[model samples]
Target: MSYVLAGDVGGTKTVLCLYQVADDNSVGGSMEEIYKAVYPSAGHERFSDLITAFLAEVTQRPERACFGIAGPIQDQCCTATNLPWVIDARQLAEEFGFADVYLLNDLEATAHGMLHLSADEFVELNPQAMPQAGHAAVIAAGTGLGQAIMAWDGQRHIVMPTEGGHCDFGPNTRQEDALLLFLRERFGGHVSGERILAGDGFGNLYDFLRTSGFAAPNPAIEAEMANEDRNAVISHHGLAGDDPLCTEAMRLFVRIYGSEAGNLALKCLPRGGIYIGGGIGPKIRAALESGVFMQGFLDKGRMARAIEHVPVRLSLNPEAPLLGAAHMALLRSQG
Candidate 1:
């Protein structure tokens, strides 16, 4: 029995998984026995710190390793987007005593994991259609917005990482333009989808609504939001229909999310489909299914027909990136 190690490194947490590869070189089973281990990325500036902790928790050393990171990977070195840590693959390979080590953008991992997911694992947002066999897009929102695309090249899906999320936010209407202006003022120009679609974007949207005198639940909730990061709190309230302001904020977020999804689809010409992955999509499924997202997605005027034909689905699995890393590692080991 051969085992491989995989890691999903994020801004807030890192997940490690061990997998058992079968005779056919496919993952037979996996045990996510380890979780939520404290990784002070700021203090421990090396990938070895986290790898050491992960090794300490597991009994056996993995033959190979791969990591899905939050930042661009170039020349075998990766710098995390939300953290100060820099990861060098050569250094990690030497320290871990592995024959091979692979690093990929987090969204790339998400795209790879799509091949491993069963239909039951996904929730279809647009059921009236099916994905065409061409290209597929994956966009996720967690600590930041991440986008990637996979091209169906006749035989297999080729995963490609993108900086589409960093592109300028193009507002459609007056209200959206106002939101863009607000974000620009706060961010000092170059408002990207990341500005309005990430974790921080939720709070920014809520704050905008509150300031615009939208109806809120109570002064106490507002105070709680002001005192702390309020996106999750506000999102929960909005999802539960507790606060009008939160609900409106969420609606706007969904609209922007759908529009961005549309933009990505257009750029990629993703006939295969659009898969929405990330921490935020699963949490806000209700709002996304409430027609706001779909409407915005299909509201591309004359091009609405193109958007309508594309199927949209949400990835419900949080361990997808880890699985993707393991798959990448497995492929490399076999090769």
Candidate 2:
């Protein structure tokens, strides 16, 4: 029996899946699952430890494996952005006796996964505009902001990885200018767009508003923020409209998200479409649909009309990266 392993490696958690493909190796053949599990990345000191544990749970070995990791990938290796771990495809192959292995930047894998998604997998943020055939762009905010470009080569989609998220955060208003200054003081250096647009960005914006004396922090929300994931807590209260401060923060967050998404649209001129992936997009679909996101998106000044025509979509499938890694593993096994 031949099997392949696929994984989605993140800062907070790691997921591993083992799949057994049919003997014919047809893409449509039954790809039975052998095993699947999730592990807390912080619980293990090394990725090797986590991988070994996954293998221990299964009796059989996989012919090949691929990992979608959150970081820049080079030469089949990647050093995780938020986690202190270095993953090398060569090391994994040598140690596990796998026929082959691949390491892909998480966003690249997510972009690859886009090709296999159905219409139901996407939530239309702008259905008014029809999708025209051209280039496409993907922007995601999670542990960090990730960007990718997709081009149709007259056949399949080719994904090009980029670190555009690390680009400087351009504040469109005086408030954002102040927020940038605040983040500068907090980080003591260059503040990238990710500083205000990723998972930690929620807390950063909230803290800036409070510290800048623009808003008073609610004691109840403050307490909850301390006890739980600050960003999640803020997002919950923001969406609920239960706390004015949280709600304002949420508004600002979506606006920035929208503005950045617009920036992507302008950069690539993606008439094919723009995909908003990552964990945050699907959660705040309500706010996204409320026109606030579009307000910020259309604030593109002269290019506003051009961007307005670009179709924007939210990827509802959080496991797209994992699925893409699995597909890559299948290709590696066949080769």
Models, CA RMSD each: 2.3, 2.1
Could you tell me how far off, in angstroms, the CA of residue 137 lies in candidate 2 after the best superposition? 1.9
Question: Residue 298 lDDT in model 2?
Answer: 78
Worst 10 contiguous positions by lDDT, candidate 2: 25-34
The CA lDDT of each predicted structure is: 0.82, 0.87
**Cα lDDT for residue 156, candidate 2:** 58
Candidate topping TM-score: 1
Tens digits of per-residue lDDT for model 1, 27-56: 433333333344545565666777887778
lDDT of 2 by residue, 134-242 (tens): 8898999887899999986765567898998999988898999899999999999899989978988989988888888877788988999889999999999999999
The lowest-lDDT stretch of 10 consecutive residues in candidate 1 is 27-36
Q: What are the per-model numbers of colliding residue pairs?
A: 0, 0
Question: lDDT of candidate 1?
Answer: 0.82
